[model samples]
Target: MTSLPPQEFTSVARAEAPLDENRGFACHVLIIGGGASGTLMALHLLNASPDMRVTVIEKSALLGCGIAYSTTDPGHLLNTRVHNMSAYPDRPEHFRDWLRQSGMAPGATDESFVGRQIYGRYLNDLIARERDLPEVSRLRCVKDECLRLEETPKAVIAHLGDGTCIRGDRAILATGHAVPVQSHAVLTSGWDFTPPADPGQPVVIIGTGLSMIDHLITLLRNGHRGTITCVSRRGLLPQVHTETKPLAISRGHVPLGAPVSAILHWMRGLAADAERQGGTWRDAVDGIRAHVSAIWRAWPEAERRRFLRHAASFWEVHRHRVPPDSARWLQEARDRGQLRILRGRFEEATMGEDGLIAVRIRTSGGERVLPAGRAVDCRGIRRDPAKDSAPVIQDLLARGQSRLDPLKLGIDTNEWAQVLLADGRPSRRLFAIGPCARGAAWEITAIPDIRVQCAELARHLHAIEAQDPVGVSRG
Candidate 1:
């Protein structure tokens, strides 16, 4: 068994299941994955019902910080502003207030964008404070990976990697980003940037999205002198964040269920109108941020595929933005000939005779090979979860309890965040949120979207629990 780490500002304390012979009886909620999504779900459940109990099963000792927020780099500022990144949508200033009192960012404002590590600290503080609450001491943070889940007549049993089994009334799949864990040779992951032996040696990145920008920021801030090349189909970069009021848009005005082509034309007109009215396209895009999921839900599978084929890249560049300072650094790097953007598609990577990584990419004209000291796959968030997702997800897929959506963007899920079985039926006991259920919502990767989903799911679960009067074993 991997012994749980002692609790600290960053580490989470673990609680094992009771060793009673009847331990298979019902518990309240088993929230798998202790990243931001799981933590939010737990908190909302606790608030929804006075006696609700939550057990969070997470492999990593870092409680609330997942791969995204676990970065130790000081240069990684959050793409979203503090005003909109709160854990609670009703309390828009919750994170801002925490930042002020936590002593980490005493001077942070609503508009200020801080380091991702700092936000991770904020999430950790929430968990720590909740743990200290004796009156509501129902949340259990377990440091173990859930291998698989089995459904019973009354409860859901989760089998952990350490050979421990825990039963709950419900199991939530909050494993945020499908982290790519397997090792590779020629190409490295964008998540973990390993510094090359020679900083002067050229580096090639395989995507021009936000992830690529993150690599660039890290390299530039660390004083890397090599010429960096970023390659993608269109070489489109995320729009830079600027101070402008988001245009107020009504849901009725949005053309939900429209074709991808129609939606594109409508959005372009909206942006043009925003510019004519003294604002920029950013304001117009931001206006429809909350309605993105609704628009996505309205679309059928054919339209959704059309979006992925044609408009997904364009929408991402507009929706997911880069912070001001990072954008400035990137532009300056380009102006100084330290950065190069290539419009092409990454083909493959192989070791070259000169001991450098040779990255092959196909352009409009032809294919070419670029030799570099290191090549990193900065292919943004959409990873093949079938091969690279966390073990629990893989086990679910294999067991026919869950399957990847038709697009294979993520696990198949209904609108309510319920994991769909391979036979096209929703599982009553198993639920997935965040990136694991990406097929359900287009804009759910952001904190604002995820927190809302968590709150709503908790309420739904609470209602179901209230209907079932069966209580869990106290022992």
Candidate 2:
């Protein structure tokens, strides 16, 4: 129920100059995608030095509310606890303090799992504060999709879908996760769902992950009394967070630069040790958070693929935990026979004469037929952006402005998050962060990791601008 500060945004003007390499650009920073990552990067840039100007272009009608926090459902709670949800890592208690100050939670606790919408509001407020600063700092938000980018030595010209082109000295591709992919019987992804006409009609949920829980909670709250079947390859659900002090990794225990199997073995040993010491495995998982990026980077190409293929599922289930309340709700649903979890692969789907959906699944033993009035795919976010329908991304790849990672999980970027061209050359004017930069930093999606990236990137840009202010000239 807390009210957020009013956002004051100015319109960004398209460059009037012709698309010539001789032209100079006016904008200092060009951020594509006004999601959480882009917003934070802008904030960091302005805060580091007030002399910079930023323009954020987003396809969404709304800014700040990316796919993660765009949900209006109260049931969609933040997976991370309130204390650890701060936008800035330096101010660790920033989010919790804001909750209390805003009167959203008079006395917020560390374990509080607030609605994700509230976090989105916090982001909007944070960005607004940064934008309100005095002279030498200007931030504009453009509501349009960036279709293509033409990078020259002097500047980067971003072409918008509406025939508007803007030029900036540097561009950061903060485009978040791609549109979720549809699976066998499911036609779409995420929390979008329409309840069947019959409240008692059965439902099948493909992939038992966070998305599945979101759909399940929504259905149950909407008075659904039918059986719910969740099907996945391993039927693995995220572990629940418990109230325990997280412990750091003991010295020399976490194996860095090791193979996937060795890393998994090390983690298991650490988890067991933590359990023996009256701490939970969650603590052990949290301990490894700081090193995951390095570990992934240290891994050889084969080891990286090995981790993705053999250990990703188990690691994800343990690392990204659900709220305790959600876990209990799921347990209760299963105990009452209202929910069922099965390990299987989706083979095919058909429409039955009874107007039901018949799904053929390949289980451990044999094939089985499951019928449901409706189905939803909760298989998680689409890691590969090349598989998406984003015109801008397609254009980038087609023009060789950007290339896919070796693993094809995301765009190719170097260690510093600079986007690499198809020819394996890093672009001085192009950078990437968040999910798109996952290829560079395997753990770059979360707030803790992204905030660091923003700080570093802002510093790097500031240094570059200081060295040659007239280098990226605006004529």
Candidate 3:
């Protein structure tokens, strides 16, 4: 694959030409959110179909970073290894190669983890190269939030917050992860608890997931010496990535249609077997990672739900391993007695007499009242249109343009990611990718997964565009 050139930001006035009276709509594709997933989809579509016109709408002023990569803090690092961070699976070493060529690193296979900001820069460069294509005469990017989406028999119309509408043959919703949930007590306090500046105050994190780890990193980097508490029902921190040698496990080790109890027994038996053979359970879990999706798919919905209710937390902790460096930092923080991880449930919260936020937590033992000078919730929020704050998603849900998944995981979609309607039919011109497609494919959030979806969606869109002779002719 060719490396993308540097991006040049120009105003819409300078880059876009006046729309011709005969040219009915704006572009062929109108991608919402110019983050990693959105830009990758655009790049794939343009490369696959050179004559296609693409336009990306980003609510933030910057593109390619979105919320995840928008952080300016040097402490925020990529959790995955550098080897698996490539945007393209075919070009397995693309990211490592880019890091070496861009002077971000000295070698391709260096074990050192790179900062998130550098990844943002690399994404921007990729977008720039796609924009510079010759066959792609129009690659307009608008800096406006989409407030509403109107689905017509012909095309999907996107209404911008600034009173502008753009129509496209197809729309791809790559709106990345939503903001972390904020505890009601913290919100009622009206306190500005931005990290680094207000590090003296004790804060309680809601979830002990990866997002919590990110917030913890920020708090530590900002020189906040105060006590930090992380609370969760399970209080399970992500597992640390190990460098143990690989071990092989056979496919038929566990039989299908086994009950949860039976499966747990089998897993335990396998662990004991491995240990007796001078191998650790980590090897078994690593082997399971290679076949997790298959296992997940094979299990019935009831079994999946049972796992979610019973063993999801523990499974997640083991599945989502943190980088070695991050694990070291977390370990040091714990050794220093600055960070506390508690397993409990949040009962209620109120403002204390000292003008701080007081939270009542119910743990396995009993109840305890804790006070924090300030608090920010790090429990990542789900993107459900019925419950999301975004006007666009709310409007779409209200107008029957989209439907929520039965489990409320995200928006409902068909296998191809075509947004499903309340009538249980797929929309021809509307599709969703990335986290929004969690309802269809449970494993659609990560970069590698989203990249593959983008390529597949691009191919599907290209086939549709080809079917419309008039649309192709106009373009």
TM-score of each: 0.94, 0.91, 0.86
- Candidate 3 matches the true fold with a TM-score of 0.86
**Cα lDDT listed for each candidate:** 0.82, 0.78, 0.70
Higher-lDDT candidate of 1 and 3: 1
In candidate 1, what are the lDDT values of residues 1-475, reduced to their tens digit?
A: 1112234355664553472223332247889999888888887887777767788888888878888887767788899999988888889999999989876678989999998877777787787777767653777777889999998767788998889888777789999887665355778888876567789999999889888888898888777999899999999998899997788999999999899899889889989999999999988999988789999999999999999998898899989898998899889999999899999988889898899988898999899998899898888665688987888889889989999998898888887788889998888788899987898897788888999999998777676665663421110
lDDT of candidate 2 over 1-475, digit per residue (tens): 3323324222233332233222232347888988888888888887777667787888775566678877766677888888787877778788999889977676788779988777877777777665555643377767789999889877888999889788787889888877755555444355575666788988988889888988888788779999999999998998888876566765466677877888888888878888999998887789888888889988888999988888888888888889987888899999999999999998777789988888789999999999988877677777557866366767889989889889987888887678888999888788888887687778887777888889898887787676665342111
Tens-digit lDDT track for model 3 on 225-272? 888888888888998876644456666764557766677677677667
| Candidate 1: worst-modelled 10 consecutive residues by lDDT | 1-10
Candidate 2, residue 294: lDDT = 83
Off by over 4 Å in 3: 1-14, 18-27, 107-110, 134-138, 180-193, 196-198, 244-300, 383-385, 467-475
lDDT accuracy of residue 114 in candidate 3:
71
- Strongest candidate by lDDT: 1
lDDT of 2 at 215: 88
Better of 2 and 3 by lDDT: 2
